[model samples]
Target: MAATEQQHERALEIFLDERPELRIELDHLNPLLAQAKGETAAQYRAERLHEAFEAEAERLGLFAWELTLQLTAASPQDYQAQRLEVHKEVAEMAGMTWADYCQLHDL
Candidate 1:
């Protein structure tokens, strides 16, 4: 009955299949979105890298759980549990936790 069971299996597989890690280049990131006036290509590149990283991480984190909707409408608790599990998996897959990453980058 739960979406996390068999019915969600295939979609989960496909989504995982689609999200591959990318090598990032983030030299210029701030001015583009925040300061529209002085935003140069360098900033654009950084912004793009940031956006890409966000999207890739989201997908990899099993936010694609909508694929599991065919199985059931998961409760908030189920979704939260799954999200945490997915976040952990995603962070590990990408080589760090959110905390470790933020701290490492001094973010």
Candidate 2:
């Protein structure tokens, strides 16, 4: 049970396979929250899932992608160091842990 570059790739491929649905989920994650009473300000997160995918894809020189992101906000000056989390849905399907996720991404 060794993890290799190909295994890493397969993990990411699983993510890309569900990318469209993931994008939709992000947009609809909190419809109830959006409709909840009393909040004067409306907060909607930007839909940059595509861009994030594209950037990583291009940067890695990979045509098809297999990765998902959860954001990180570090500090005022460390904005760029806020590397996004890359998920592969093994969390739900395979009962993968956060530690596993971190290990997979070399965090």
lDDT per residue (tens digit) for residues 1-107 in model 1? 22455645554444344543332234333454645655776656545654554475467553334335422335767655654565556567888978985575343
The Cα error of candidate 1 at residue 9, in Å, is 6.4
The CA lDDT of each predicted structure is 0.50, 0.44
lDDT tens per residue, model 2, 1-107: 12345644454455555577765665555656544643322243232344455576667754222322111123533322323322344344567776787586564
Residue pairs with backbone atoms closer than 3 Å in model 2 (clashes): 12-66
In model 1, the runs with Cα more than 4 Å from the true position are 1-5, 9-62, 66-74, 100-107
Position 78, candidate 2: lDDT = 38
RMSD of each: 14.3, 14.5
| Model 1: pairs clashing at backbone N, Cα or C within 3 Å | 28-46
Task: Report the C-alpha displacement of residue 69, candidate 1, in angstroms.
Answer: 6.4
Model 1 TM-score, all chains together = 0.32
Among the numbered candidates, top TM-score falls to: 1
Count of backbone collisions in candidate 1 = 1
Error of 2 at 100 (Å): 1.1
